[model samples]
Target: MDFSLTNEQELFQQMIRDFAENEVKPLAAEVDDLERFPIETVEKMAKIGIMGIPIPKQYGGAGGNNLMYAMAVEELSVVCATTGVIVSAHTSLCAAPILENGTEAQKQKYLPKLASGEWVGAFGLTEPNAGTDAAGQQTIAVEDGDNYIINGSKIFITNAEFAHVYVIFAMTDKSKGTRGISAFIIEKDTPGFSIGKKEKKMGIRGSATCELIFENVVIPKENLLGKLHKGFGIAMKTLDGGRIGIAAQALGIAQGAISETVKYVKERKQFGRPISGFQNTQFQLADMNTKTEASRMLVRKAANKKDKKLPYSVDAAMAKLYAAETAMEVTNKAVQLHGGYGYTREYPVERMMRDAKITEIYEGTSEVQRMVISANMLK
Candidate 1:
């Protein structure tokens, strides 16, 4: 088997790395400091086709595969996890489902705009009580003349206020449990669809996380994403792919932290010599770098499986679980290596540490990833 990257993939990776360092990294601290979303930069990324890395060219995307998408997320995340998640949620959660399950007309209608970044996409599945238990969908959609009238709410939605299109799941037949669910494409301009409370998160501050309240929102029948009552399957499968993005994101964060710490130790002196000269510091750096490399392998493994259309659920779960823990460990050590300066905003390690956390929380918690992995093992 060959290990070398194709010329196109290598060039794409380098371009994204250069863009992240020059464009995104410079604004990362300020965005974190102010909790401000960098709309202009996101649009710039759209122009460069980062927004549609895995989307097919026919849909106005970059025509790259899942591996390319993973690399792009990793590069963006090294400088700014917020940007990483923004692109991830749009591609993995929203566009992916439409591409997979959408009717030909639905794809023709939504994919181009989504791929072009003319419309930002968001996924709405989690409700107050329906997070892990997706079958407990409280949002109900009733059949109306030529449409479905939906009334329910979703909390902890990323890209809630910023998204122009939302892939929402609601209960169409309450008695059927998971099979009772259905997915719909709801445009942001639809009447009765409104933004609710906003969540101030511990990390990924620049990415909007908020509530979506739909009250008697009328959605045309043509917007139904897939077979009726198949949304639970859709959501679960989409999450498998989304986890790959989080894994890559975590990998990049760990790398960013270790890289910063390495530079700091070489330049920072203690007693009479640079701290990096100490055996303990060298050991810690070694561990961090090792974990970073391992996490990258896991992410790439998952991405490759996805691109090949192979069974990737187990792979994704393993990757996400390991990578998230790796991020937490590596970032913690990076902070320790930097001493008090790492705890403060004076350095990027502190922010890197903060950003690494959500990789364990969203796209399925680390605990959930373990369950997924274990379940697959039995299967």
Candidate 2:
């Protein structure tokens, strides 16, 4: 199969790279320090169509392919992982499910606004009691005369605090186990729906994450996403798509750490000579470059498979697992290469290290990714 990027893909990658370096990098530190959402930058991304890269133009997106989406995610992540998570959560977790499974009315009601970035979208699957076992979700939705009353809380939801819409999952039948779970579209302002306190996270500080509390929240029957008892399938499919974006985010963070390490080694003098002159440092840089390239290729392969409508669950899982672990490893080495400076906030490598850790933990933990890959292999 041909692997070269088309002219359009090349131009798209260049555009994202230029925007990240010129616009995002400048304000990343300030946003992180202040724990601000960077709404202005998010709006700018929307204007440039980075917020909806993979959706069709008719849905108010840039009408690009999954590869373009991954490239944009990587570039944005290199500059600011917070921005990358924002877009990834919006596109893959939220919009992808609706695009893939929603009825026409659901799409018409939600997709355009989410695609245009007029309002942010969030996906709710993980609960305080259930995470990797999403089928064990405790959130319940009971049918009530043309509406469903949802009751439960979702923890660790990305963009939960600021999102205008949410694609939520709740159990409709306890006896059916995984098949009992169903998906619903719930608006943020609906009665009995409120957000809990924002989570103080280890990294990606500029991205907002919070708890979603649903206390007998009523939603119209029309808001049901896909068929009842089919939410588990939708959630899994959505997460498979999300894994590719997370993998790209990991690649971007690794790239950023490596780039910083390279600059530091070149200018840092150790024992009367530049550290870059040391064979050990050179070997570390070489290994980092190789791993980063490999991670990028894995992400591209998974994305291409997704574009072709092929079974990409294994590819996506492998990409996320390898790339996230790679990010952690590279960032740790970057810190070591920088010596004492790497441990301080004075260097971006430290922050990158913290950001890299979450990539492994969220969007399915590294362990979960391994399980997915192994399960696929066994089949």
- Candidate 2, 109-208: lDDT as tens digits: 8888888898898999999889998878899999999999999999999988889999999999988999999999999899999999798878899888
**Which pairs in model 2 have colliding backbones?**
none
Candidate 1 backbone clash number: 0
**Candidate 1 Cα misplacement greater than 4 A, ranges:** none
In model 1, what is the error at residue 298, expressed in angstroms? 0.9
TM-score of each: 0.98, 0.98
lDDT of 2 at 171: 98
**lDDT computed for candidate 1:** 0.91
* Error in Å for residue 237 of model 1: 0.9
lDDT of each: 0.91, 0.91
